[model samples]
Target: MKRVLITGGLGFVGSHLTDELMAKGCAVTIVDNLSSNVMTPADYPGCEVLVGSIEEVYPTLLETSKPFDEIFHLASVVGPAGVLQHAGVMAQSIVMSGEAVTRIALQHGSRLVLASTSEVYGRAGELRESDGCQVSSDVTVRLEYAVAKLTSEVAALNRAKVTELQVNVVRPFNIAGPRQLPDGGFVLPRFVVSALSGEPLTVFGDGSQVRAFTDVRDIVSGLQAVMSSGKNGLVLNLGNPANEITILDLAQRVRSLAASKSEITLVDPKALFGPLYDEGIERVPVVEQAFSELDWRPVVSVEQTILSTLDWYRRRLGLSQHESVGVAA
Candidate 1:
């Protein structure tokens, strides 16, 4: 059995990754701060979940001499609203987690896969893996989070160059699906919940912003593909452009799919993000490299992902499905 360590293994992405890895017969240990997730070992049967920041747990982890075959670093201060709370500390958290995981992976000869963000591209479209992460001198929370994630990537690559540590960086664009909460200012979940509750789906900035929402299920599958493929020192953009849609269209789709009489209201984004928004123009990913290297491509459609998320919310909220959507968009 393959043994792996996942930092933030209980977060939205990390939790899905854990389910897949464990199903494939990999022994997975998780280190999550539980800032977003609230669960104990009873919630995740058969998985050892360590609840704390990586920095706080590093010393005890090293003392125990736990050897892992792979390390997946997915921990960070996420979402637009989430980063607003950590203006000065987001960059610090990114670097600290990067250093701890990089060192541990090096010590045990474990392959490393670091989760990054497409926010690093900064207002660019058709983002390729080779593009330099755009840096802004102004005070932008989104840019701060992006630069911090980029810093972590740089540090990991520097370490890989020296010790031959197999490092692959995954820059995911607009991810959504099960277990995602709207508290973090993620647009899709917020819209879905509002539509389901017979409330208006708020569209920030005329809902013109174009984003390609990749299902978390497909994203985790892409992560597994990166680990399975014998590649080293490569950066891959893992998202589906085929699922691209505008925010207004997304809201319309949600209202239509849920068969809700909810209205799609246009609201100023500043009202939502509270000076925490960056006007990024049409952020999409270039996934040719991921497909060529890992033989991976997202198979889930935007409509399918939306219905799947709606179904999850329905079950979680104790509401039955719409009774009309039978795997049909």
Candidate 2:
């Protein structure tokens, strides 16, 4: 069996990827600090769960000569609100985690996959892996997260070039699905929970921002494919362009799907997330590379993703799904 190490394996994307790798019979070892994750080590029975940061546990792994064929570095302070609220801590975590994981990969000759965000593009249109990142120079909390991710990417690529390690970067678009928390300023989960609770679905800044939201399942599959067959030192944009939608449209869709007597309300970003928050106008990915390289394309529709997310929230909140709220045609 292949041995795999995942940092932040308890997180939203990490958890899903852990499930996928375990299903494939890989001996998965997860290192997580559980800062933002909800699942415990007990949740994954067969896998080894080390309850600590990558910086702390990776040295022990090296000392013990624990072999890892693959390492997925997904540990980072995610979400707009979370990053903005704790910019310094987030930046520090990224730097420490990136260094530790890259060193581990080099030591063990393991294929390394780093999880990046579309935020690196920073208000760009038709985002491709080749496009130069337009990170803001302004002293805003948003730039801290983007800069940290970019720094990690550069460090990983530099290591790959020098050490000849197999390394790939995946910049995922707005990935939405189960196990996402509403408190992180993620629009979809907040809307789903509000709609289910008969509260208004809040739309920020006129709700005109366009985002390409891919299902978590599709994103995880693409990550796996990249690790398996992707060329070394390649950066792939893994997202479904077909699922692009406006925030207002997303709120309306969630309200309709939940069949709740909830209002769709518009709120300013300043009021909701303070002055540090700035909205991106558009985040559409050009994913032809993923298809040509990995033979991967997202199969889940936006409606299906939204419905599945709603179902998950319903179960978690102990609310029964309304039979009358059928899938929109």
lDDT tens per residue, model 1, 206-283: 788899999998999998888878888888899999998999999999888878777789998788777766567598
Best by lDDT: 2
Q: What is the lDDT of residue 303 in candidate 2?
A: 89
Off by over 4 Å in 2: 323-329
Number of the top candidate by TM-score?
A: 2
Residue 78 in model 2: lDDT: 86
Ten-residue segment with the worst summed lDDT in candidate 1? Answer: 320-329
Cα lDDT, all candidates:
0.84, 0.86
What CA root-mean-square deviation does each model show from the true structure? 2.6, 2.3
lDDT of 2 by residue, 1-329 (tens): 89999999999999999999998999999999988896789999999999998987888777646689999999888887877778667788888898899888888888999999888887667898777888666867778888888898998898887786789999999999998887778989999888888777889988888998999999999988999994899788999999999999999988888887788888887887888887678889999888888978899988889999999988988777763222223
